[model samples]
Target: MLLIDLDRFKPVNDLYGHAAGNAVLCAVADHLEDLLPVNGIAARLGGDEFALLVPFTGGIENLKRLAQQVITSLVAPISWNGGAVKVGATIGIALIAAESDADTVLHAADLAMYQGKREGRGTYRVFEDSMDTELRERAALEAELREAIEHGAIEPFYQPVVSLPQRDCVGLEVLARWRHPTRGLLGPDQFIPIAEETGMIADLSYHLLRQACLDARSWPSHLLLAINIAPQQFQDRDLAQRILAILAETGLSPRRLEVEITETALVQDLEAARTTLTSLQNLGVRIALDDFGTGYSSLYHLRELKFDKLKIDRSYVDTITMSEERAKLVDAIIKLGSSLGLVTTAEGIETDASVAWLSGQGCNFGQGYLFGKPMPKGEVMRMLQAGPRLEQIGISSMPESRIHAVPMEAIIHCGVGRAA
Candidate 1:
């Protein structure tokens, strides 16, 4: 028995509508039919899921090969409406036994398929007895998460985003942390995917936003509060309104709030994202594209969306000191931001060299452990009250700035910006 689940299928439906989604599904069905062995029964088990029951005389090795082939076939992009719609499949294999009931076999395969998803996309897992226990634990954790959301147990931690060269605290990025009763303190990685999968992300996000907004009430007016919006939250048509309402209730001005979104969110539904972003912008809120270099269509998104800031992903910054090519890329990104009148923030700046290089390259903002890790609300309050000073945090003085203002000469040298 093979249970297959399609990944990234919703994004296609969201971007191109249900017609494109149905077309892609039909294409997948055709591929399954072509790939199935003799006497194998291929069935559509419902939305973006399929099952294959094959009468096999072969060993487990052959089934493994067959699973890989199915994965390869299903992952190919299907052309739709003059564009390509791509989706990936995760397969779970279960061997049929005379004593096993149909329901039991299907449940085992389902658990295995979910395990494959948790590991990563486009992989296969064979049914194992241990998966059942894992599934139960996951269910219990989900229930605990739901209760925690209701009780507002999830807390926000703030990481400071400092000005380049000067290294002054300019803003704080709010991150989520869960205080689990049995598990102690849990990071977002432990429960965020579960929240997203179980459709509880919206509730959890709103809860966190409300708390963060309230926490920011004591912050200085000039200091920004940047909060990341999950990709799934973009699907909510009332997203802008809900956030605006939260701001109003908390008595925090919309101007002080920055909504950071990933490229994955933008690609999901550009029209919807544009509408929500425009609404927020009109209300004096700022929009920033987060994890900038990690996405496929950064330039396209920059052109289409009215982003106020472009955040450089940490991957580029981590290697800039060691890799000359990476340094050039970072320089180019900063130049790109400068030309577009958008502020550029570099993430994961840990060393003095990284700080010096980024500041020299004219990156406007810097974040990462070199400055400060995400701290609880109490530490954030104390830091803000104490004032923005590197000496307070025990960091040494920063090197002088190499590129200060983007003068006409520098613009000409960089091959960007118009002559003033």
Candidate 2:
């Protein structure tokens, strides 16, 4: 049995409407029908996933070759509604070995498919016994995530965003934390992708939104709160209405809440994403292009989406001081955001040099451990009550003024005494 997953399916579904998504599905099914033998069965397993039951009479290499053929065939874009959509599939094969039942075969093939996804998709994997443990652990994590939501085990942690020009905390980004009761605090990387894969992201998103809105309501009125959105949640027709309702219930102004979405998430279906973004914008919520510069389509999206803010990805921020290329990229991004009249925030500002560099480049805002790490809501509340620590300084006051402000004599005297 061979199972194929359209790895890039979500973008197609998100960019086009479900109707166009259905068309792509039908097209894929038609292709499979044409390629499979008379006894083979091809079935839709819903939402960009398909299953193919092929008789186990062939060698594994033959199945791999077939998968490659399917991938190559799909390289051509599918025409739908006056536009073309491009996508690819990853296939997993499990030969019906002796003593293998349907469940075991399916499980093995599913693991193989995931292996393909890990290797960058558009490929295939044959079942191996070693994958069984990892698959089971993932299944367990998925189950645990569902329970975590029910038991209120997932909590919101706030990471502060500092205004570089003012050196004062202006807002907080609400990040999800999974407290496993026994496993201590777990980051989103541990279970979020599984949540998205299993279609639990919508529920988790709403839960976080409600919690974040409630927390922000208690904070001082001037401070803003930003929350991340999974692309899957955008599929809901009433997402804008739901967000507005949450704001109303929490007594928080829509303007105080910012929604951060990845560039990859928005480029999947430009038209549908535009419609959703327009709806959210009408609700008075600010939208930011989170993790910018990581995707191939960031520049194209910036022009198309007209986002309120641009968040520079950490990969560039981390090495900005060491690499002239990275520094130039940051400078260009800051200039781009300024020209577009959008606020730009750099993430992963861990050192004073990096912070100074960003400020010198005219970047307006930043978030990173150098400012404050992600902490629980109660801790965030306490910190907010403590008020802003450093005063905000302008771009002209950076590097030179900062250096002049420090006592150079003290450093010289300390070095002299140590050398003696």
Candidate 3:
């Protein structure tokens, strides 16, 4: 059995139309039928994908030869109303072993086809044991994750965002944690991609955001709650309205609630993004561009839309002390934020020197492992209670701007309790 995917087929539909795309697919079917053996069965497994089953009693070399022939045949340009349509097929071969079942064999062939595409299109790859096992494990994990969301196992854990030089705990970044029944606790890095792939990311994010708001509603007004929003969530036309409802239900003040948008989210649909973000701002809630430099369109986003803050990505911050160029880049980013009036935050502030250097550069905020890891509500509450006390600041810890950053020791002492 061989699986084939037609490359560049989408361009025909985009450049021409679906009618032309269908014509190209039909041409591929014709080519497959012509190339396959007399006893072979050629099946159109839906748009631009075809499969062939050839009963072979010979060695693997024969299948290789047949795959190459199919590739050669597909490479020939098809005349569609006198316009030449060109495409190539990536082939994946799955040989039937003694105990192979129909579904398993087809899955192996599908994996092999993708492998060929990854290795480079217009080539063929044979399925390997590891590939099949990995695919099956991923599928199983996806199913488990879907069940976890329904069971309310995914929830928010927060990491603090501290004020620079002063090191005051000004806010917390809400992060999702999956309290899996069998797997203990799993962080976003472990399950977020699966959630995104399964189309459950929106649900997961909303659940966390609403819960975080409810939890933080009673916190001191000065301590903001930042929720990370995914790009997928913005596809909904009523995203802003839905957030309004969440705020209303939780009684969390919009002023103290910050929504952080990653670069990936902003670049997805600029018009929709601008409208949604503008609506969000209209509600008096602050917005921050999260992981600033990594997105596709930073300059355009800054120019066309408004942001309350810019969180510098960790990549640049990590190299500040190690490389002069990186240090200068960080300096420039801080300066840009200052000029544009965006509250600049240095993300991933790991060492004391980095914190000192960022403060010297006039970064407004800092977040990283040096301050704290993402923890449960109770632990965060304790840390919040420990605010700007000299003990929390290590009694003598001071930045170069310690005189100007007068609130460093006292501000970390801000306390939070249940609303009475």
C-alpha RMSD for every candidate: 6.8, 9.5, 8.2
On TM-score, the leading prediction is 1
Q: For candidate 3, write residues 1-420 as lDDT tens digits.
A: 999999877656754678898888888888898888879999998878889999875788889999999999999998887778888899999998789999989989999997787677999998888887877887888998888877777776766667778776666666777787777887677778667766888777777777787777655655556667777777888988888888888887676667778766665556777888899888887788877887655887799889888879889998899999989988988999999988788878788999999999899878777876666776666654554522223322222111111331211111010000
Model 2 ranges off by over 4 Å: 1-6, 9-96, 101-106, 118-126, 390-420
Candidate 2 lDDT over residue span 298-362, tens digit each: 88788778688888888999999999998999899999999999878888888888888899889
| Candidate 3 deviant stretches above 4 angstroms | 1-106, 109-127, 390-420
| TM-score per candidate, chains pooled | 0.87, 0.74, 0.70
Model 1 gets an lDDT of 0.79
lDDT at 297, model 3: 52
TM-score of 2: 0.74
Cα lDDT for residue 127, model 1? Answer: 92
Q: What is the lDDT of residue 95 in candidate 3?
A: 91
- What C-alpha lDDT values do all the predictions have? 0.79, 0.73, 0.75
